[model samples]
Target: MGVHSVNWEPFLTCAVTGAGDTLSKHPDLPVTPEQIATAAIEAAEAGAAIVHIHVREPATGKGCREVAYYREVVERIRDSGVEVLINLTTGMGGDVVVGDRGGEDTPAPGSDFVGAMERLVHVEQLRPDLCSLDCGSLNFDDDRLVYVMPPAYLRPSAARIRELGVKPEMEVFDLGHVAFASRLVAEGLVEPPALFQLCLGISYGAPSTPAAMVAMRDHLPEGAVWSAFGLGRMEMPMVAQAMLLGGNLRVGLEDNLWLRRGVLASNADLVRRAKAIVEDLGGRLASPKEAADRLGLPPA
Candidate 1:
């Protein structure tokens, strides 16, 4: 589908915070659970139907996979009485950093690889409305680090995530990843009308362009509900591209820090901008309840 088949009513998601090391780049990036929750609330108010969450170490500002941090963030969001759906990330604990190029079969010192179940500890405990299921491994924006998620790990993780009654937003960074995700859906691991998030513009992944978004959308499994986002400067452009291609929209500090060339943006700022683009294109923003129904998720 292309501009001829635009998604007239699309839901918007705000990745309130990500697991990336963006603290030094943006001083106001949400670090503590309190700050993250506040950001989520603000993003929801600005027009996000769903808020994607990733917890960080309060003191160091580095992402951590602790259940305590996840729990606190979830609890705070719940207490605020916001009507936005929560989408927690399960993309952590899959890094495999190799040291030397010659003879290093063993994982390097910075590797954080763990079993599938171990990575979902937070999702299993918090049971958010949605959680990411990174479909395949990729060179994680750096030569030395590769985010590893082979089928051996993904099959079991998909089953467990289904058992927990939470929707898994299959995250596809490349075309091959989309094929593997289709295989998982064929195996009945992902529920009917499986959800996908096309991650564009990361290193060694699909570029953030209209052609790339159209290619990924064409390759998606039949009846799959998908959204797409670009990194850095491509973030806003993909918003219009994805919406025009019959897909949903996503924008946040997690993907791009700049509202413009030199101005830093909060999650809410990005969401508001995306909302305007959607409206300008004659598209209606879906409410949280509407998005939940479309994705087959329980109410937030």
Candidate 2:
């Protein structure tokens, strides 16, 4: 799918809950396996073609990197009869933080523990139709931690992704990440007609704005299918913005937990609202089959 010269309808994906704070932030956010599966089904019913999942610990709301949890979640979603595509996160394992004054400080809490193979382990085991490969590292989360995905790390991960036959959503926060992703494709680590997700409005990486969105979208490699999202207040607006610009739209509690101020949002609510937004703007939203075709995902 080229960035241009194609008749594009905005394909919506609900990012449900990311691997971040949920117990304190939103009361309705899905934590248990049952909750997660139900939320995903509701999102699919509400017109989200894909559900971007980040599993959590059943007891604590802490994000879990457990493969078993992911397997159970996938099972529940499959048995529930929802036709949406499952896009797992290969992003959680690669976080790195260094302490001040080298070894003197107590190693400022690093999430970057595993290499690409370890990062790709769950995906290889579960084999979701789509999985995210955070193209490069940035200073993610508040209070100094890095979500590191160096190219040396990415090459093997991308290769593993291809080996499993899962579509990799190359998440680019800036133009340089886009360039590096293209390099990955050229190096044959990533396959032709790659898929990308242009993540915007995160702390200390890139601001969510129209001009910046366009500039980054314009920079994607030819024949690549891409999606974009903005955090907080820009979330809904960026949905419409991405549609108008001929890219896909992504939304959910991962980026923001509100349908409006003080109104808690479920994954379904987010998807229903996005469906309405595109419709209001004289654009149509894609069905699961349409989205799968658009992103080269297998038929449902």
Instruction: Write down the TM-score of every candidate.
Output: 0.97, 0.95
Q: Model 1, range 1-300, lDDT digits (tens) per residue?
A: 333477999999999889888999999999999999999999999989999999999999988898998999999999999899999999889988887754556488767888999999999888999999999999986678889999999999999999999899999999999999999999999997799999999989899999988888899878899999999999999999998888999999999999999999999999999999999999888999999999988776
Best candidate, lDDT-wise? 1
lDDT of 1: 0.92
**Candidate 1 versus the native: TM-score?**
0.97
Instruction: Evaluate all candidate structures by whole-model CA lDDT and list the values in order.
Output: 0.92, 0.84
For model 2, name the residue pairs that clash. Answer: 95-111, 95-112
- Candidate 1 ranges with C-alpha deviation above 4 Å: 1-4, 101-106
Task: Provide the RMSD of all predictions against the true structure, rounded to 1 decimal.
Answer: 1.6, 1.9
Residue 81 C-alpha lDDT in model 1: 92
